[model samples]
Target: MRLALATAVVLSLFTSPTMAEPTVKLHAAGSLKAAMSDIADLYEKTHGVTVARAFGPSGLLRERIEGGEAAEVYASANMKHPTTLATAGKAGPVALFARNRLCALAQADLAVETETLLATLLDPQVRVGTSTPKADPAGDYAFQVFDKAEAFSSGATEALKAKAFQLTGGKDSAKAPEGRNPYGWVMESDKADLFLTYCTNAVLAQRDVPELKIVALPEALSVGANYGLTVVNDAPQAAWQLAVFILSPAGQEILASYGFTAAGAL
Candidate 1:
């Protein structure tokens, strides 16, 4: 995707001795903080602009927009929120920008074998953690994993459900705690015994604490989490420009480098 960008000029009207650039505010997924910070610096240097950012779970970001939050560009860990906004004519059609996967991250010594990840979560001694399902793909993906396991191994499923304590499954699961996904409870940093997070978030969190070990989900149960970005109908002018810039090859390259799967691979 090639975009024709306007070139910059050397102006002496310099209050800052450089081009006075427009600043854009971006609301992004919390898991994307590391990669976004790296990408933002490169973008700011290339385009002579500044990108101010706020990061959190996708669900929180979505509700913010629905309630009339002022964000020109909205990027989420999943495409659904953007699509919901687009359907209501609040945001542009969604563009899948990148993708990630859910992984179980546990203390290094407590890490379980790959083949037993699902079973390990069921063990009473092993406490598993995850994000809020309605608000996070990782949280929902965790439920899918458990439900799939439930169909194949009823006892394991039941035991794990008991251990997990609060899942909100499709219908049978509604009885789950009002805001919790039994298999993967809605958790953030320090919110659970074992955090269920995307690979990116795990990587970023490790920079703060190095004791965590990432456990890959079983292939039969896990699904990839795709991310998307779009321009909100009411975004400010600067936000629009930054949104456009992020859709280009330059932005995709940065996203892909940080363990994200990019668009067009299917």
Candidate 2:
């Protein structure tokens, strides 16, 4: 009877429903923290699985993934980073999950709009801020917007780059005070008069400080940001399930609520 009981216990351990679920490790971009965290919580509540998340600049996270840090899912601020991972055999196929556009966040009284945008940044008295290039996709897109700015007026790219302050997003950007958006924090601390960042981020910051305004970028200088999602090459089944959920209507709805556009809506 002891031998039979021991055999039954071993079989039960293998077949238990509670033990069937797997915990997935998700490495995602900093901008995704809010939306992804909420989605993960909802997913766990409904599926009885857990999601472990690590958030940082997409490029830095991609480097870690390339270095073989154990992650099951990768969501990047831009499609290029995930595509690079897949090209290096570190991740699976890349999927464009959402899109964003660059906008200017300014003090309540700052005179900045699409019409006066370029002139304001060019003014020496105006303090312009942006993320750090290469280290963060937001910064890279900011610079790309500057490149487009060159079209409206010659040498606008170099001029904007020279005047823009690398304030919030960087390889060594300091953590903002708790419950504060980095851009808003910088603006509130008098570090910058205008900050160029994702439109979604601008909206989030406005929630923290109602006085902050989001100025739309003109079509000539607008830069579109594409968010990508991919599973690691050896990711568990749960990772793929989460990825599918993100692409599902429910997930898309959550993203839309957070100011993100449908993947092709740009």
Candidate 3:
């Protein structure tokens, strides 16, 4: 069944496409699922190539490349991470794709605003969850939130740590001390009061979970996170084709519709 499912989903690649396209495998950031998938389908239709995406934390994906997991194109949650991957010889020249901000979000049924969300995370009543800094770019971005809170001063790290019951989050947290993690740890949970993540994640989450409320992040505390794309070692031609398509105007338009901010535009 899994094989059949895979074949059907990737059926476009096996058949000869009009654009002389090849099948490309893409390893992308977890936060990019919605935007990337939307662009991928359009890219396949226009370019006659199929792009298969494997989404996960950027840090771990970089590690996968370092450990020799073969890939073609890599899209990271933050350019810094893909830049780091390039530096470490795991990737190639990366181009900026889109930018997002760190948003403190919760269920609309609650009354947590931006200020209240941050305060609540620090309060004993809130048990915040964030992706692990070592494994996910969201974790690093989350830490940056605290970094901004302190103006990069002392005690910021510890204070951020204290705002949570656990530092580890996402699928990899099974390897962590928490051992059990929720599927969707919204900021306003029945048991907790605050959660932190990127606005990109919220955009994707809204597709299925419409009750999510967005907390307005203060300009002083907010950060613009960039998504980056790069070619990997010895990847197929289809990868390059998809990469070009993503950089094209059509692809950019699709991303913009999903709240992506182009770096060069600013």
Candidate 4:
């Protein structure tokens, strides 16, 4: 009778739910939402561990983590942010997980051409929307593209910069109007003639609003964004698992389907 009771107790301890993997806290960049969400879902289904996510501009997310916010994983839109964290001893080594490019998103009727993209942006009647620089890598990339515009016309860089409105994609952007896609809502509301954002985001917007057009930037005027990720220094073991999964072949497939290039491809 005593042996049987001890055997039952040992079995219960082995089967306890507490032995399962712990939930992972994930702080990811806004541009990676769809891909990361899909990966998290898949991971949860197979691993029995939840991934709690908080998405925002990479720079702001970094700021939060640096300001004592707790998260196990940090995925950034650019290499600099994650590298910064690792250098400060907050995270592990950074890895380039994905890549994207800057593009212009506009309503169907807007006439934005790759050949005259800078000229179109400079037109007095045209209003442009851009993310906030220093706070978001998308905005920083947009400014880099603007710098490339200088070859076509002197002062074109500053002129385009001055005219561009910091409408959305900022750390403090207004809650997207209820029931509306933030990108589409801003464009439909006439906030700007065109929005400069990631090619992946433009792809998503056009999928939701078929009438929206995605205008590719001229190759010379385009800037590629490198995405980086790292596990926080004190992260749970599951966090390291997730970081590895994102760099795995299956993870790269999901990101590719969402319009991002694998970091290895770039």
Q: How many angstroms is residue 37 displaced in model 3 relative to the true structure, after the best TM-score fit?
A: 0.9
Candidate 2: which stretches are off by over 4 Å? 1-21, 264-266
TM-score of each: 0.76, 0.89, 0.79, 0.90
TM-score of candidate 4 on Cα atoms, chains taken together: 0.90
lDDT per residue (tens digit) for residues 105-210 in model 1:
6766675866877767876777766556767556666666677787657776556545553322122332324333232322333345566667776665565456
Q: Give candidate 1's whole-model lDDT.
A: 0.64
> What digit string (tens of lDDT, one per residue) describes model 4 on residues 1-266?
22332243344344444444578899998889889999899888878889999988899999999999998889999989988998899877787889999999987788878887777888878898988887889999998988998998899898999999987767678657655566777777778888899999888777767788889999889899999888777665677667767877778888998999986421
Q: How close is candidate 1 to the true structure, as a TM-score?
A: 0.76
Assess candidate 2 and give its lDDT.
Answer: 0.81
Residue range with the least summed lDDT across 10 consecutive positions in model 2? 1-10
Q: How displaced is residue 201 in candidate 2, in Å?
A: 0.3
Per-candidate local distance difference test? 0.64, 0.81, 0.66, 0.82
Instruction: Kindly list the per-residue Cα lDDT of model 3 for residues 147-194, writing each as its tens digit.
Output: 776754466567876665333345445431231223234332343344
After the best TM-score superposition of candidate 3, give how far the Cα of residue 242 lies from its true spot, in angstroms. 1.1
Which portions of model 1 miss their true places by more than 4 Å? 1-21, 155-162, 165-193, 236-238, 264-266
Better of 3 and 4 by TM-score: 4
Pairs clashing within candidate 1 = 72-235, 166-181, 166-182, 167-181, 167-182
